[model samples]
Target: MSAFLRSCRRIFWALAAFSGMSNLLMLTGSFFMLQVYDRVLPGRSIPTLIALMALATVLYLFQGGLDLVRSRISGRVGRYLDEKLSIRVFDALVRMPLKTRADGDGLQPLRDLDQVRGFLSGGGPTALFDLPWMPIYLGVCFLFHFWIGVTALVGAVVLVGITMLTETRTRGPARASSRLAVSRSALAIEGRRNAEVLQAMGMRRQAALRWREVNVKYLAANERASDVANGLGGISKVFRSILQSLVLAVGAVLVINQESTAGIIIAGSILTARALAPVELAIANWKGFVAARQSGQRLDQLLKILPCEEERLALPAPGETLVVEHLYVGAPNAERPTLSEVSFALRRGQAVGIIGPSGSGKSTLARALVGVWPSVRGRIRLDNAALEHWASDALGRHIGYLPQDVELFEGSIAANIARFDVHATAAAVLEASRAAGAHDLILSLPDAYSTKIGEGGMTLSAGQRQRIGLARAFYGKPFLVVLDEPSSNLDSEGEEALTQAILNVRCRGGIVVVVAHRPKALEGVDHVLVLGDGRVQSFGKREEVLNRVLRNPVPLKVVAEGPGGGR
Candidate 1:
């Protein structure tokens, strides 16, 4: 957080400099009034009055210019903050723990960043900058007379106390309201994403009831915060008004005693008002201040947990040799490991088939191999380098993954195949599509590769989506491919294409690991791994593993009858 703050320190310094000048020049009006009452009016000197008025105009113009410069500097600071933190926040979201991502609104950090930016660019930060100059105005009051200075000082202290009180009263409710607001946003997003399922199953009413419960909580919290802040703002306003009047009353007493002139009375009142103005503004905008504070804290915590990438020597791009040693992995925060002591090795041109019962950790192994999920113990290495040693983006280019749940983004079929890489060439996308056997299907569309798909490929059929996902996995001729149920949604023709795709990858010396439920899907694989209850039951040559499973029928029930056929 300090590092981020330092990035915008120069802008903040400029803002402070301009704010100081603006405040200094703000005394122009008070001094002009003092001169008119003390000297110009008494002497009835027209020339002197005209000269003072002209000087006042010049000072006012400069003051206004300084205010404008300060405002622009603050705005620039806000934009700089956004530019510096937006990408980091997004990267943090991507690298966040799976459990955390599942349990909360992943997009809240983005909203938090926006809140911080808005506060900095808006009047909230300006009020804060002006707050330090309150005593400067109070000091000027002291120069006028002791009693006038004491009155202004006391008023400033009271307003500061009120501002503190407002913060104390509203802090908890404001934080709670912010959390509930994020919850409501997450629920809304989830509802939209799963709208089809809810509507088809007549669960929309239930979803609405759930949403209403959360909305009610948010409303209660928000109202509590608003009530406290508004009550405090009103009190601060009334107190400021009374304090300004009190300054004049005290100054009048000084005049009666011949201790000060009438000019000092009006000037003292104005200076007192100026001194308390920042405090009043701070109280009025306390909500925004609280929100920005919370946002900064959240962003700081998030950045801490999601560490930035350290500079490391670039490891060579992985070849076909992939090894997993004594690997243990679990769903994030789960009590039990999903895959225990899982170990395997694959070399160039080898295609391994993983057949397992449901919940037996085949998909988990695939995720671990592709670096989507962190392992609980041991390591996965590619060409003698631990997976973590390689930079994620660099390693990702040489690896391909296809999870059981096929999903596609909003784009043309070719873009999806190219992994939406803006720099991907048309030839490369075409080649990958042809390898996945999706080329013919894509060409059948009206616009071919230029056809725009809906979000999550809503416009495409299940088979089409799966095929496109396979093409994504096969993109760039990656050295290692992990496909979990890649053919689950494919028809017979699509299945044939998938089989051919696997064979093509092997022929190209790429290592392929396919998690399959059907026996035919495992055909042509060089090695076979059978898992039962998260442990490897059989791992050997394709023929040997298949023969052993067949001879022992009981253990092979998972592979023979499919994933869900056995416990």
Candidate 2:
């Protein structure tokens, strides 16, 4: 990130140079007034008037051109910053929930990046650049007259003070607004996601009330910031006008005393106005500037904490063994580890079913196995290489994961089954689908392979989505397949297909770990790892572990096969 910022120095310098040229050309109007009133009009010189107009016109064009270029460059700078940081911000967003359980922080990083980019592309940067020239404009005023300079300096000071006040007054409110915005956004998203449940339970009104509470707070914060900024901006505008009038009044006295000419009066007034212009502009843009600054700080802190993934050597696909050494896994920032001291090993072509009761950390163990959660202390190795030794994308290609909640992207059935792989082959897609027993399901769909699944696969049934998710896991013939609750939503036929899928993976020299509560899901596994309260109670052949667990009085929730229980 620092390197990227350093690269932008050249662009900023270019903007600075453009601003300088633009401001220098700004003198054209005042100088033209002076030349007209003092030289052209006095001598009744049409040629001189024509020459002055021509020169002023040319200078004005140059000024416009420079300002235009600066504006364009400012927008490009924002784009460049977005290009540099957007993916990083998105990466952070995707990993955010894995770091904490605070829904209030949802999407804040992306919003921060937006705030920064928006400010840069807007009028805020121009105001910031022009602010430094306040002294120079005042100096030009002094060249006209000392009193005029003093008056301009006084106005600048007051406006600058207002800018400071604006900063302070809006800073806290702006930050609060941003945070509340995140809360509000999260609430809205959750409401949408659970809309069906809310409607079914007739809780829409209550949900709306909750959303109202969050929205009210967001609005209040925004109002406070906007009110202060608008009020200060109004004051600055009125004061700049009053300052222009007062400078004219002072000039009138000078004219009456024969201390200055008409041209000096007009030119001095123009100089003072130009001198104080930046302060007013700064006041006007102070809110966005403050928001941008806060956003930048947040981005810095977030990036520092979760910095980009370090480059890692790409290792060969694992087809030998999967090993876990005293693995301790838990939810991020949890009070205690959810799964502790879990050690296991599996060779290629082996399948293990993890049997445990509810809240036994079966899902947690599966997540850890697939690199969803970082182990607190332990190591997971593939083919004698630590998981971290391989790059995430590279490792993902060799690992198949079917999460408990099968959330599918908005795309066709084939796309979802193929894991959205752009280069996926038709044969590979069909092969995986057939392995998951979803080929017939796809054929029955309205568009078959071209059928759109919609977001989260909302258009499909729970069983169908789960089947597609299973197909995705089997895609590319990954070497390590981990399925959490693989049969939770499957019908008898689907379960049969799932069992076959497990067998298919095992036959292909891949290791499969199935997290299950039902006995039917364990039909294809040769081994079973029994967990109780996050600890391994027993690990051995399926029959031996089941017999041992059944002999114990307080066995983990392994139950009888019956209707509505286990398939």
Candidate 3:
């Protein structure tokens, strides 16, 4: 975050310089009023008045030009901050869920970044830059006359107090509203994701009720924040006008005392208004300023908590073996390890099927094998290197995974089969599809491989998505393939294709790890691992482990009734 901030440091300095010039030019109006009232009007010099008007017009034009430049630069600075921080923020968004159970919405960081960027780019920064010039305005007022200067000073103090009051009153409500907004967003996202379930199970009304409950709270908080900031802002505006009129009244009194001229009345009023403009602007924008501050602080903290991965030396791709030693795995933020004291090894051309009763950690081991779940106490190594040693993208290229849900992204069949790689080749896509036994099925579609699957591949049937997901796992002939419940949605034909896909991976000397409850999914595997109560019950050649696990007579639903299903 600091590095990104430094990237825009020079721009901020430049903006400040522009702001200084622009604020100084603002006095052109006040000076014009003084000359018009005292010199031109009193002397009855028509030519002098025309010349004065021309010079004032030129100065005002310059001031307007300066203002336009400052605004343009301010907007650019906001965009610059976004350009610098977007990648890091996105990386955090992706990794946060896997690392922790917090960040319920998983999008607050993005919202925060947007808030900060919007505020930085808007007119808010302009008020901030012009704020420091208030003193200069006050100093000029003092030069006008003692009484006039005193009146402006008192008004300035009162406006500052109002700004402070706005800040104090709005802080809690602003923060509350931000939190409620996240909750509302999270609810909306989850509701949409499960829209089918809600509709099918007659939960639509209940879901709507739940949403309304959250939205009402958010609206209340938001309304409270707006009421405070806007109410105080209106007060500030009315008070500023009053102070301007009062300055005129004071200047008039001084004129009767022969201490100042009539010109001082108008000049003093103009100076007072100019001096307090920033405070009025600040009051109006206080809510956004607080929100931006809070969001920026959260974004900074998120980046620090989940720092970017450092570059690691590139290691040669592993094709030798996979080893897990004393592995203990758990769900994200779980209190206890789901798979404890679990260890296994597999070599090239080997296919191992993991079978277990429900809650026995078979899926947990599968996730750990694919580097999705962090091990609590153990190491998973590919060849001689720890799994964590390889960069994530590089590691992903060599490893393929299909989880239980079969989440196929939105794209064409060929794109999903190639894992959406921009450089994916036609031959590779065809080969992976053929290897997964999905090539023929794909050809049957109206557009074949070019068919677009709607979001989450909802247009495809469950079995179709599963087959495509398998093809994706086979893309690039990755060295390690792990599938959880690969045949859960498959018919007999799909099951046969899944078995053959496993065989194909083994034939290519790639290691395959299958987590299955169905007996048919283990038909193509060379070895079997049996787990119970998160502990390894037996693991060895298929017949041996199956015979041993069957001896328990537990009637495990996770594996075949007989040894390797009587193979």
Candidate 4:
């Protein structure tokens, strides 16, 4: 939250103003009592008493007005702060290394992010709010009465100690619970995400079991923590009751001796309880505070990641090349590299087709080329310099990457393709869509490109969605276009359409790289890089690689040209 400290000034002052109003209001109540006792009872005059009561009511109204103003200012500023924080978090995730972004087994790190964010959002603010109250409460108490203030001060210490102890004991359990909950949440999300797959495979029962396992563990940990908190609650009540009884008893004895007035006793008791309120809240939310702190720490860690030099480059001004040399990437705690000693180069107007079977690291290689996998060894040069030397903003402008799964937003097709970049004009959008073979399909829709696509493009056919994905890739006419299985689910007609779009990119003098298992889709490509066992098996002209593979009986198939392209 240190990152947010600068903005805290606005929020803090707003809260300070509100807190001051609250204290003033409380003091007003005591002052009204003081007036009633000193004047109203001594002189039983109705007009005088009514006038004084009216003045007290005005004071309360003023305090309430101040409180309303403070709340308005603080609430608005707090929302802005939250937006800033969320933006920073999203930018960090986008810039983080591919490995760091993923949990394990090559899933999107976004899944983990969503889980962590859910846990943090609900439980993160307690500590921050609690910290602010500490000084504010103490300052008010000290101003009220030093002797009572000292007692309040001691109570604060005791309250903090109890909270700390609860946090110390419950922190581990809370963390375990949050993690389990996240796991279950992820599974539940996955279950829904792949509901069709689960239904097809008749694995609904298995999915249910997996979900139950995680949730049961989560629920058990929650119960255990709840029991501990309940025990602490009982003990805290007994202790507080005893302390309050002693204070009241002492005040009564002092009153009997005429050392203190009934008014003083009442004010002192109320002050003590008010001072203790924050402490009680702190203890009650000890686990929540810890959870929030951990979340903030995690958030901070994520935000502090320094982007590599590649992510800092300016956009390519046309005529750029995408190059790689002796690239290698290994998984954490695994000796076997995912992409081993892989190397290739692609210049403007060049098309390089990368073919590999499942689990052969094609996706990893594609990500490395985009500078998303930064932990890999070896060189990745864009234009004439290291890819790492370019800023992400620059590289992003010049490189368009299309993953196997196209994640479309819940917006119009044109909006999704343009990513809501206000600069993208209608003509530009149409050009991109036509070039991607998505224009025909989009124009057939009632609203054309303006038609809304449901979440993840659920409303569009797989082929149509893939076309939209391709259109998104071409929206900026990026120098390098990386397509991972662009035609995986396309029919013959869709494949032909996709092939034409690829050729269109090549004709535009842009570098096109297709990561594919079905090499037949890469017909007429200039080059082919075949990967096996995480290493490059062949790197040369498509014909040369095919010849070598055929001679070695390595199962080669010639790419067949689509309609309109000569065979």
- Compare the candidates by TM-score and give the number of the best one: 2
For lDDT, candidate 2 versus 3, the one ahead is 3
Per-residue lDDT tens digits for candidate 4, residues 126-145, read 32343555555566545545
Could you say which candidate leads in lDDT?
A: 3
Quality of model 4 by C-alpha lDDT: 0.69
lDDT of 3 by residue, 1-567 (tens): 566667778887888898898888888888888998899988999999999889988988988998899899988888888888899899998888878886447889888989998898898889888899999999999999878888998999999999999999999999989998988888888889899999999998998898899899999999999999989998988998899889988888889889998887898899899999999998877888999989988888888988988899999999989998999989999998988898889999999998877778888888888888889999999997998898889999999898888888777989999988999999999999999889999999999999999899989998899999999999999999999888888888988999999999999899999888788999999899988888888889998877777677875545433223110
Model 1 pairs in collision: none
**CA lDDT, candidate 3, residue 434:** 92
Model 1 misplaced stretches (Cα beyond 4 Å)? 97-102, 551-567
- Over 142-179, each residue of candidate 1 has an lDDT whose tens digit, in order, gives 99998899999998888889999999999999999998
Error of 4 at 66 (Å): 4.7
- Kindly report which residue stretches of model 3 are placed more than 4 angstroms away from their true locations once superposed: 554-567
Of 1 and 4, the candidate ranking higher by TM-score: 1
Q: lDDT rank, highest first?
A: 3, 2, 1, 4
Cα lDDT for residue 425, model 4?
A: 93
Evaluation by lDDT, superior candidate among 3 and 4: 3
CA RMSD (A), model 3: 2.7
